[model samples]
Target: MSEIQTVPESRRFLSALGPGLAGALSVTLIHEGARRVLSHPPRMDVLGKRSLKKGLRWFGVRPSHGRRLHRQALVGDIISNSLFYALVALGRPRRPYLRGVLLGTLAGVGAVLLPPFLGLGRSPRRAKRSTALLTVAWYLLGGLSAARATRTV
Candidate 1:
């Protein structure tokens, strides 16, 4: 009989990092590209900027302004999204699509519902139904990307 092998938590997280980053970058590329082409793309960047500024203030640091603020927000978004997607590493290696769906759904719902409570702004749903839905889909895409990238690593 063959014994199943289990990876250490730290190793799992480390192994997941590259895939997580790939997922995050994919989402950003898609989102930014859509923003350029679509007349009404999801403006999640606004929320990200607001959230980052608020976080910095809470930490007694001043936030940047103009293009610099936007750049900072983009970086922050990638790092955060990577960490969130990395949670999938805790699950079994098989059925990555299922794991992706679950993680993506959770993040999607939170993106639409949690902003107001967090003082970031109103929910994305309040702006436009299509945009809100697209926002969710974007995260879903990220999840799937991370899941697929895991196979290569």
Candidate 2:
């Protein structure tokens, strides 16, 4: 009698990582494109640079624009996307579209309200409603993509 060996849950989760990354990159692309089309100032890269700058400041290192900025943004996307999809996968939503919408709505709400509260003083809420909608839509698309992608995993 031979017993079957199963892979660890962590290994299983690792299988889902690529999909999460794809979802994040896709969201960034969609979001940036919308922002450009709407003539809104680029915001995503700024978020990454802001965090990186704060971290570097503690080390007495000054951050700059261009490469460092882009790299940081990509890294942020990877971390955030991985986390989001991991949660979704673990939660095992019955309907991905519904789950995506719910998750996206929460993220959108945060994007709209948190910046100002964080002392960044950005007025997402006060800004034109369409801008907020665009942000939410982008996030929604990401969630939807991630959920669908993870279905294979």
Candidate 3:
């Protein structure tokens, strides 16, 4: 008779947790790098007019647009974090990095669209800050849960 090998549930859970941590850390590093670049406040003319326009479009808006788009980006970051944590909680591991990027992008768009669509045209700074804080909190929670999962295995 052939024996059936069964993996322990704890091991399976921990394996899933590993990828989630990797994804979260990747996001945090990317975010910090982007912040560092922004802090330098690159000159508009140094990059040239055409390149500058392209960059603004890629980032989803012009510099003259104020912090509205920036706030959306922050909200997107929070949404991405939430998605990562939700995946971890479900023990699902498939394209974590890509998923993070997609979720982040969607969140950014949502932040831009939601307020104006709902006719709540106030500054988005407060909402952005709140979202960023929530993201950090979610990351902390995910880390703790992953740690516990590791210990169990």
List per-candidate RMSD values in Å.
1.9, 3.0, 14.3
TM-score for candidate 2, residues paired by index = 0.78
Per-residue lDDT tens digits for candidate 1, residues 1-153, read 999998787998998888888878988888888988998888778889999999999999999999999999999989999998887655778877788878887888889889999998888899889988998998898889888888888
- Lowest-sum lDDT 10-residue window in model 2: 85-94
**lDDT of candidate 1 at residue 89, scale 0 to 100:** 52
Candidates by TM-score, descending order: 1, 2, 3
User: What TM-score goes with each of the models?
Assistant: 0.92, 0.78, 0.33
- Sorted by lDDT (best first), the order is 1, 2, 3
Model 1 misplaced stretches (Cα beyond 4 Å): 1-6
Please give me the total number of clashing residue pairs in predicted model 1.
0
Model 3 local distance difference test score:
0.44
CA error at residue 56 for candidate 3, angstroms: 37
Strongest candidate by lDDT: 1
Clashes of 3: 0
Candidate 3 residue-wise lDDT, 24-138, digit = tens: 5444544545446654321211122333345567799754333554444444544444445435434334344444444445434444345445444432334466544443433
